[model samples]
Target: MPNSSPPVTTEAAPSEQPVIRWTEAGEERSALWRSERGAPPPKRVVLADDTTTADTAYRQACEGTALLWRGDFHNARQLLQALARRADNVPARKRKKAAQVVPVADAFHQHRLAQSQRARMLGMLLIPFNADYSIPLRRAPDVKTACTEAWGPADAAAGASVASLRELLGITSAHEWRRKGVEIAALGEPPHNRIHPHYGVFSPVRGEYIQLVATAHLPKPPPGQTSLMAFDVGTGTGVLSAVLARRGVRQIVATDQDPRALACARENLAQLGVADQVQVVQADLFPEGQASLVVCNPPWLPARPSSPIERAVYDEGGRMLQGFLKGLTAHLAPKGEGWLILSNLAEHLGLRSRAELLEAFERNGLRVISRIDAKPQHPKASDASDPLADARSREVTSLWRLAAIQ
Candidate 1:
């Protein structure tokens, strides 16, 4: 249901790149298969062009046949839209009927299965790109910059390759986000407020959580300590670190294990003019020493992530959450507070329970001193048509204030 199969690609040898072979122009042609999400190369591929009907393409795609587009790029996009309409065209009454029969957890699983299947089918539509990341089809956009940002400098020696048009579009979208940036009111107004998210790093679009950190009470430094030191664990874009710095924390150490996240956090902190006040480090969870305040906003769901980006959303076994809680007490200074920013979405979805979370804090020698809650302001929270809309509507994000047990 979760697309659990490992990626399978045809590799000539361990040292060679995986290749996709297909028949075109009465000749056997092959090229490198590229998938940022580690999707396997299609087992069967057929060339499709302007003359290809959306219905035919949809049928072929459903049967696991990849369509290598040779026609106008815009047509391919339109065909993809058509495929989506057909894929999601199930009657509303039927959907409601299905939802009525299944439990919420079962519904969530079924929803994931549907999503996985849809992605596979849609990904069957491929676009060819030159080694420099240029699409050869007429009306294709200039995507060299976006591709370079996502895949790193293109290898001119690797020749042409094929990838999902959807993925390319996503890269393009992420590039725009990186360029335009997302504004954080918690950081202040206008020109100084934006946080430019890197291609793979998670964007802090949910401002409620950021606001929670921005307004939370800073713990008093122990007697005789003149300055406040804080640790921002798993800092994705350094947004929380910036907030801590702005709140007058003397020095803040922000740590993340991901290279992209580390780089992203450093760049954002500099851009926000707080680089001098924050130190971005690489670590699994906590850094070397204890801090007066320790903060973490781990992934909300305890489910398997399909890709690196999804890691910011799914925690698989609540690993990050537990890791932070278990290590919080050891990383907090005397009388210091550990602020855990988390959502109740997992509980609403039945993936976890509130009692389990509280028990985790107690088991880790931590006691909840207080909590600050914020209602989600994201659009999905109000989107009644979403499969999990019922759960989302009641979702509340909280910043749990914890201190080490005496």
Candidate 2:
């Protein structure tokens, strides 16, 4: 097995105190014990091996402790899994059952309750970091850049703490994504072929919207006229813009407000060789000029985002959707079309209605030209045991092609 021991460093010993040293499985570790007035002596101990479960470590941590592992790195991973399973097995408060029956609303509430409990349980795992973004323990690699990307670069002598095993996993996944980009096949053939998505930018996991944009019928240009221009609002990873550019659009404007998303989009567009064709700008939705085509694939759910990553999944107050519907007409060229790709999961959840959506478009001076629908093919669609399987089975993603009411 390869050595996974993290790089180590020595610190200055505390004055006026004797540092206590101990040996565990051939490895030496040291810590300073201090007595404050009538306080008990600090319980300084170390882990026997990497097989130590996080739950055990967590219990020790609550008692003011630390762990020094001696086993293989892979065994530590198994221990973490065991800790996770234990955490998940913990039961939550039972809900009151109605005398008559459970309604659809009750089912939704129950689902949300279970989700909240799961989040709370998984959030107990805490990870520590040093001022310079280093984990101060054995076998810990330098995570400076990863921490910087997620939490910004640390100030001089400043350190922060983060909890939640879910978030830690997210950061770890983000690090891997930053190192190895997500592959995007939305971009078509020839000049524009590939898009490498960065960490913060939303990955193109749902292929339905991209397929709609790629296969949609485009209008022909008149004689002596150049190719049409299209705008990809919220061009996360610049995937949509690259797809448009590959679809024979003469010029493309990709707009986004998030700095991270903008940077991610720029890199992806550049790598896909569509940077010249697609001009990425930091705008909330539309730029100054009008385009023959406009595309938007906003968050499908009308729910609150608990964290930054959830922003890609939840749209608060439907701001992005409303903004696109309201400002789209002013930025669309004559005879232009606006493609709105959205999922109807919110409808099944009783959050929004189809009538309300149609009314919103009518009030915004836009009318639906046509719609293309696709059924979700994700594994969750077939997972009958999933809590949201009932809703997922009825979910459908639609590409609502719209045009300004003449």
Candidate 3:
């Protein structure tokens, strides 16, 4: 069942009572309302009951009003469902009449805009949480661990209050994922070595990219040499690092800026028994020094992240990609290779171009040694209901092997 608890209001009393009113039957029920001293009374309020649709509650929330749900716990969930349907039902804007279809750039922008709007609308539904991480309203189960995992413990002085329903749902989902763990076979081993990703850490749901890393031909052994060190940059959950370690790399340096990702990678690597072979480090992109092989699986999309959590999926303004390209040469041992695992989904969406990537490589004095591509097998690739299915259906993930031009 959907969680449908309204956010708890924390209005404080002001110097005097402010107006408290509700409109019904073309009449207003007025009462004096006071908040804590110097604090303001709630500007608006709405009643929540089993009969109230999530849409109605959301509408009130959008208007800066709160819904005090008096409905059954389960009924609130149904209302949330109604609200979601309404939010998703908006017709997409008609394309401008032109012989040429909308450019991928414009389509990408519009897609992001629509996504932002949908998120905004859905976020209006609020969920209240107590200091003990309990849902105070009836039928509210304990969500303390979930909330703590996401928000880093509750603030008691701040008092029990409400938060966006969307955020609450996300936290709850993260909790479940953390507990159960996502099974990833990309490491290509027995059950004991599987990767378990944490919340906010990008899961390698798309197997194509991981396959690219796992199958790409490693650089030839040095003259009379049999071993080389490899680095996996931004190694979320250490999937790529484990893949490299399994592929016979003598040593692997895996680095990431996110603490959660670093921790997740460490745990997964340890589980895989490759911790001794792979050294996990906290670095923005590349760790100090060069390596015989440097690989990075950066966020494929080049756009601003709407929230901090989206960083795993969105690379704002292509900063990470650009940083990788610009810094690859400095981190590559002479004759060594840099394997960039990327998706062409951004190009399909019109967010970036093939030429731009090629140009970046050239400008960095890096030449494509070889390119290997694989088609995405995710269900979304075949999901016709997805607004961008047409583009997704044609998406390809690739491993771009690069060598310094020098």
For candidate 1, the 10 contiguous residues with the lowest summed lDDT are 1-10
Residue-wise lDDT of candidate 3 within 1-406, one digit each (tens)?
1123333343333533344444433454333332211223345555566666555666765566655444565666666777778766555553333224677677667778877766655554445556566776777767888877765666675455555555666777877877776665766555654667776776777787888887888986445567787889989889988888887787889999988888889988888888999999999899999888999988889888877567877898899999999999999876789999888999888888899999999998999989999999999999997768778998998999999996
lDDT (10s digit) by residue, model 2, range 224-310: 567888889988878888788777787888999888889988887778777899888999888988888889999887777655556
Model 1 local distance difference test score: 0.89
Write down the TM-score for model 2.
0.76
Ranking by TM-score: 1, 3, 2
Cα-based lDDT at residue 248, candidate 1: 86
Which residue pairs clash within candidate 1? none
What are the runs in model 3 whose C-alpha is more than 4 Å off? 1-47, 61-71, 91-101, 154-158, 220-226
TM-score of each: 0.95, 0.76, 0.83
lDDT of 1 by residue, 222-333 (tens): 7899899999999998899988887888799999999989988999999988999999999999999999999999999999888889999999999999999999988899
The candidate maximizing TM-score is: 1
lDDT of each: 0.89, 0.68, 0.73
